[model samples]
Target: MNNYEKVLVALRRVIRATDLHSKRLSKNAGLTGPQLLIMRTIRDLGEVTIGTIADKVSLSQATVTTILDRLEHRNLVYRVRSTQDKRKVHAHLTEDGADILARAPEPLQEEFIGKFQSLHEWEQSMIIASLQRVANMMDADDIDASPVLDVGAVLREDGWKETKKKAGA
Candidate 1:
């Protein structure tokens, strides 16, 4: 195969791997990949509006609303109208939702995170940088790029921070 075709094939493989992992996660956790992602987003950003969730998850607002509808119907989540802004609705996890979220299995793709962590620091940086370059070549927008890739920083317990210490504040 030509160089371009080979690259396309590799990209397709990565996409397929992601899809397969999501399906496995759904079967094991009783939550689809997107649902679990949304729950985690809600946990991180409490009482978030639908638009905010959509933005955080890189999904369209309508898609998030549909997922929220299912979550609400399952009694895993509930929406409350903002008292000061009647037109705004914020989504919060119900007790049942929290319970489910607590028990939900990690995504199969997360295995990659563990493996990535096992690699040498330089190896990890190289892999991430290569992926970021590939993403840029594919015409992914600047906003869609991961901060971790852009800044060469890891999401530590304290949050996203540069790996290298700056000379001064």
Candidate 2:
């Protein structure tokens, strides 16, 4: 296979692994991957704004708002308008939300964190560096306050170019 095709195959494996893990996490914890991630962020940051949550979760503002809507409708969180700023809405966990957060599952697909924690510090660092290097080779950028750089972003940019060539981004 060509280099690009080989890379595509490897990416498919990564994506499939993530999907499988998300499904398992959902089945075991009753929370989707993204929901669990948001819960953990809320637990860590206490009261936080939607924009902060979006940045923390590596999602677009609009996407985070939609997730927050679902979370709010499920009574997992509450939105409070800032008394000082009025226009600022901060999301706070409810009692139920807190309980849920306390029991929330791990964010990583596998018990990678647990396993990594068990490794020697140097070993862990090496593995992380290797993975990060691979990610960099794939052109994945840092998530927060940086450019988007997942397969989705690559696809979007390339798709736009292809479409423009065909018709007109």
Candidate 3:
């Protein structure tokens, strides 16, 4: 195969791996990558606000708020206005949220990061440069994306239904 074909295959493999992990996360924890991430951040931060969660997770506050809405609807999280500062609402995980989060599989990037960190510094730099070049080549450098690696919408509850519909499935 040509070098370009090989590159495409590698990219496809990466995407497929993310997709598979996403499915497993949904199946095992009933949470999307972003949802899982937001919950984890809330648990870790304890007294987090929507803005705090958004900043911690590298997502927009609006996106975080939407995800929180869904999570709140499911009884996995709750929000309360602080008496001292009613304008700033704090997010907290419910007992059910903590229970599910405790059992949720680690995000795919956790494993990737562990392995990436084990690489030599120079090798890491090279990999980063190459990936950046690829992004530039694909004209995706300007895209607004958080650190979440899951495929599809960050917190779409329906999973792949939209993709399937688009594909005429």
Best by TM-score: 3
27-91 per-residue lDDT for model 2 (tens digits): 77666666677777787899899899879876666656766777788898889999999888999
Q: Model 3 segments beyond 4 Å from truth?
A: 155-169
Q: What lDDT score belongs to each candidate, Candidate 1 first?
A: 0.69, 0.67, 0.88
Query: Residue 64 in model 1: shift from native, Å?
Result: 0.8
TM-score of candidate 2 relative to the true fold: 0.61
For candidate 1, which ten residues in a row score worst on lDDT?
A: 149-158
List the pairs of residues colliding in candidate 2.
none
Worst 10 residues of 2 by lDDT: 145-154
TM-score of each: 0.60, 0.61, 0.90
lDDT of 3 by residue, 1-169 (tens): 9999999999999999999999999999999999999999999999889999989888778778888999999999999999899899999999999999999999998899999999999999999999999999997665555678988856363424433554456
Residue lDDT tens for model 1, 1-169: 9998998899888767766665565566567766777888898899899989978866657667877888899998899999989988999999998998898877543667788899999999998798778878975434322211111111221112221222121
Off by over 4 Å in 2: 1-9, 109-169
